[model samples]
Target: MKAHKSKTLIVYSFLLLFCSCGLFIDKDCFDSNEYKFYLPFTLSPAQDTFHINDTIRLRADFSHELFDSITLKYYKVENEPLMCYFYFFRIDTTPTPHYTNQFSIEVDTGNVIISPDPETALRYIVYEYDKSRYVFSVKFIPHQRGVFLFGFGSEPQQHVNFQKKCPGELMDIYFTTNDGVDNNFYMMAQSPDSSMNAVPQHGFNRSGSYCFRVVE
Candidate 1:
């Protein structure tokens, strides 16, 4: 009786497999199951700039991978006007940052974050902006590998161990270009707690050595 039961189970398994294969082999059935869903934006923090009253310039260089159309939005805290323009003719292909006459910003002190929403797959879009001068140079995404902490020392210590979460870690970074033309990207995590003795928080970690470079 046990042998007979095992044979029946094997038959059922084969039948299930045959049915599931219809999803791929059965074109008509597959079309019926077709559905459209929201595809998340594929973009990274290409580069950041920080400066005081000095002009902040940005030039974007893109590769074929960035072929998809991108929508860019610039947001600043106060009523500050952060100017921006898209350069289609000239794209700076070097490690240096270039300015465009199309974009300009007028702000006393604050941060300007720009996000590009590319409605597609692994395609990417580069965003470039500048500030007059800032306290320190902004840190773009790390190219190295190691665990990182964000919101560190604050009430909540948020840490990033890239091994666990890759491409999804949140960063609280600002930009600066005060030192010199060579931009210094620093790794920093925000303080999660307001008191002492509390564990500090961080965003993510880098597993390898990461050099800050333009994605173009």
Candidate 2:
């Protein structure tokens, strides 16, 4: 009986040691600090104003980042009929026609030598109503039309490398109909060259003249 009790105690000790070691290993593997890298830059529209059937381009300049690898994800507003075609441009060169039209798409911006010129910039275009919005529904009414609101999502939130370390921001671009008023609109006046980095404001309607009027 003494020997059996000793064996049981030895087994319990081994089990306790195994569990403690496993807990430590998991803690080391999943340290949140290790994955706390900030996003390189913020996303904005190359041209602020957009209209029905207009091809909008969003640009992000990462020419000053040290990291070469990045993962970017795009999301759509919930319960909204809005859709966008995403395209990626490596340099000033024209991006390929390949595009993903969906509620969301992911892109891996591979490593590239950073440069100061706009050529080194990455461009994303959101195309809405390739043919006509009316084609979707014969009863489509002008006033009932919706606007296009699309933006980017980053793994680690974007941040500006300032003295105070400002967190990076994202602004959704709106493509309002010619006659319809979009109260959610805001002016994206910040030029790509501006030193102040933040997502453009929301809630100011973009002028109608900047948008394309589609005629069916």
The candidate that achieves the highest lDDT relative to the unseen native structure? 2
What are the per-residue Cα lDDT tens digits for candidate 1 across 56-169?
Answer: 332222221111112121212121121211111111222222222222433222343332432211111223323321111222222222222211011111222222213222
Per-model tally of clashing residue pairs = 44, 4
- For candidate 1, which ten residues in a row score worst on lDDT? 202-211
What is the TM-score of each predicted model, taking all chains together? Answer: 0.19, 0.26
lDDT of each: 0.25, 0.27
Q: Considering only N, C-alpha and C atoms within 3 Å, which residue pairs clash in candidate 2?
A: 92-119, 158-168, 159-168, 185-204
lDDT of candidate 2 over 115-169, digit per residue (tens) = 2344423223222222221112111111112223332222233222221212232
The root-mean-square deviation over C-alpha atoms between each candidate and the true structure, in angstroms, is 18.7, 18.2
lDDT, model 1: 0.25
TM-score of 1: 0.19
